[model samples]
Target: MQKHTISAIICLAGALVAAAIAGASFLAMRKPDLIVRGPGVTDVKMLSDWFPGLKGTPGDTEVYILKGADDGASMLVLGGTHPNEPAGHIAAIMLIENAQPKSGTLYVIPRANASGFTANDPQEGAPQSFTIQTPNGPRVFRYGSRATNPIHQWPDPNVYIHASSGQTLSGSETRNLNRGYPGRPDGTLTERVCYGIVQLIKKENVTITVDLHEASPEYPVINAIVAHPKAMQLASDMVLGLEMQDIKISLEPSPVNLRGLTHRELGDFTDTLPVLMETANASQGRLRGRTDEALVLTGKDKWYVRAEKLGRLYVPYDEKGHPLEERVGRHVTAISELMNSWNLEHPEKPLEFEGLPGYEDFLTKGIGVFLLPLPAKN
Candidate 1:
């Protein structure tokens, strides 16, 4: 063969190899898993139902609505705002798949940012999915990214100025769903998702909005409730109630200067009271030794334990670690307590639900037991 012919053949082979790798990567990110709804989910709709502009976009996500026969107040729970935090998302899923409202309405969005779940933070070395064994079988859930996938909305500015409060953060934060509250209809994809959520709260006349999240064990905000000023009283009561049950949770006032967070912006922009809860997860922490499925589920990290020993960690960490079940349990129990506290304050508009496992139950039984089985193939 001619020298030029040989060179062209080699180049063609290299291009084919590159294309194959790219195709595989795309499939890994785009594959969707089945999440069977529980008895409580009476109706399911997309976030686009509230904001038509989001229809057909990756920003659109599912909203599971559970309504009771009696007239009462309504609440909205958002999980998976930051995809790396599995506990928050799983806890919300637990509610969606198990809890049944008897006196009011419950709106649970387990994957509030569906697009985020389609990808993982590139440098994190995190697992693509984690499994929980149910009685029926093992169910796998995605371990996603901390922000909206940039592929959906790119060209972030050098600095991101929040639309409502003009608070500036790093450029990448523009894609953070929590920071895009009271979102603008014409804003970026992240802002649009936030806008859709705000629209839902307003249109439904939601009384309370709770956003579930997890922070690194080294982060000071872990194992605490950050409530907007309007929600402080209710949150305080709930914290006290949790204390009675031996669940230690701290209460932090949403900072006025921190303008774009859910606790801050959602409370400031809407009539509905807003609160956010955080649990500690070593997998997402800088002090974590290795990032993988075991770290995601077991939460045990030698580095975290050493940090705890040095008193450098915010929450207590040991060899046993702060397993996923414990983190998820804290979230589920706190949410129930918040509802109970809300009921005590507003008897006429009480929100009641059943079939949800509390902290002790989760600690004793584990999270996999409550997860529903995946649907059988045709």
Candidate 2:
């Protein structure tokens, strides 16, 4: 064979092999992760059930309803709105797998941005997946992006304007599910997902809505709860209860000018009283040293510790670090307290749940114990 022909054949062979590997990886991402339905789960539905526009789309996600025998109010909990926040996602999973509603219905959307879970954000060097040691074995879960996957939503504008309020944000935020609340039915994939959630809240008559999230430790809102005006009283009572239990949490009013966020728009547009909670996560910070599974799970970072000593962080940091368990614990406990306060204020419309592990349980036993082992078929 000629020299050029020989080189061309070799290059073609290499290209074919690379394409095959890439195809396989893409297929793997398409396979949905496992989430074992706990005893409390009374029914499972799709987001499209509430908003049909999302049917057959990657934006569609599962909604787990845990209903109690007694009649009362309904509460909605959203997790994975930002796929990078492991604690938020895990807290929703834990509630699904462990909590038993006793008085009202508890609806959980653990993967609120399901498309985001299928991929990681580019340039973050984040792990594609992480493992938790369950009693049976190690259960794996994807670590995804903060925004909807670009594959599902394309071509952000130079600046994205909030449709409802006309407030503008960076174009990239158009993909943020939280920033698209009270969303349009025929909008971008992220907005459509937001629209579906709003429909669920309105249709279900959700009395209290809690959106779980996390921020970089350096962020001022770390370990805080942002409550809408109507929900402020309930949130304040819950904060007081959390403090009584030795769980310190700051309170922030949802900014009036924030156009598309859950606490702001959900409260304004829907009947549900919206409250959003944020926990500290060092690994998601810009100052994070090495982004990996260890950083995601262990939450120990010397850089963050030094920054804490320098008074650059909102939350206190030590060698012990803010492990995943602590962050998840904070979310779970705060959720319970919020429900408690809501129940007390609205006697006729109460939300109740049991079987959730308390702070000490999470601190000592860790979150892995609650995760179900991977299914044999999966």
Candidate 3:
């Protein structure tokens, strides 16, 4: 063969090999994670069930409903408002697998932003998934972007205007599920997911809605619960309940100026008392170093510890690190305590459940003990 022909063949072969590998990775990421349903899950429906508009879209996610033996009030719990915040997702899963409603119905949407899980955030050097060792074996899960994948909803405008309140924010926030509450029926995919959640709340008459989240350690809202004004009492009681157990969580009232948030829009648009809880997640923080699966699972970073010593962080940090166990534990406990506060305040219309792990159980045993090992393929 001529020299030019030989060179062309070599280049073409390399390009084809690269494309094959890229294709495999893309397909792998699109493949859904294996989430085994537990005994408590009585009905499993898609987000599209509430808002048909979400049908056939990546934004559609699973909604797990566990009904008590006796009828009572219903509560909705949301996880994965930001896919990078793994604790919220893990805590929601723990509730689905472990909790059994005692007096009311428990609704859990573990991956509230289902599209976000299909890809990692660009330029963050984050892993596609992480693993937790179970009693039987290892269970893996996706580590996704904080926003819906750009592939699903692309080309953000110069700025994002809140449809309901006209509040202006960075254009990229258009894909942040947390910023699209009481979502529009004909809006972006993220907005539609939010709309579906709102529809479910309105249709089911959800008494209390809890949105779980994680913030950077330096963020002021870390280790805090921000509740809508109508839900203030219940949140305050929840804080006290956590304090009694030495969990040390704070309470923040939702700001009136901020629109599109669950605490703000959900309360304004519906009867449900919306509350959001945030944990400290160093892995997603600006000060994080050596981003990897271990950092995602352990929440450990010398940089975070140094920043804490410099008096920069809002939450306590040490060589021991926050760890996924502590973060997930706080969220799960807060959820249980939130319901406890509701029962204490409204005995006649109480919300109660069982089998959720508390602080100590997660601290000593780790979240692995709570996860179910995936069944082997035949």
State the C-alpha lDDT per candidate: 0.90, 0.91, 0.91
Per-residue lDDT over 1-378 for candidate 3, one digit per residue giving the tens place of the 0 to 100 score: 899999999999999999999878866887767777877889999989989999999999999999998778889999988999999999999998899887889999999999899888888989999999999898888988999989999999889998988999999999999999878999999899999999999999999999999999999998999999999999999999999998888889999998889999999999999999999888899999999999988888999999999999999999888899999999999998998999898899878788888899999999999987677899
Q: Taking the tens digit of each residue's C-alpha lDDT, what string does model 1 give over 1-378?
A: 999999999999999999999778766876655677999889999999999989999989999999988889999999999988998899889999899989899999888888898888878889888988777888988998899888888988999998877889999999898888888999999999999999999999999999999999889898999999899999999999999999889999998888778898878778889999999988888878889899999998899889998999888889999999999999999999999999999998889999999899999999988988777789
Model 1, clash count? Answer: 0
The local lDDT score (0 to 100) that residue 155 gets in candidate 3 is 90
Residue 376 of model 3, lDDT score: 86
The best-first sequence of candidates by lDDT reads: 3, 2, 1
TM-score of each: 0.96, 0.97, 0.97
- The list of candidate 2 runs beyond 4 A from truth reads none
lDDT of 1: 0.90
Compared with the true structure, model 2 gives a TM-score of 0.97
What range of 10 consecutive residues in model 2 has the weakest lDDT sum?
Answer: 24-33
Q: Is candidate 1 or candidate 2 better by lDDT?
A: 2
Candidate 2 residue-pair clash tally: 0
Give the runs in model 3 whose Cα sits over 4 Å from its true position: 1-9
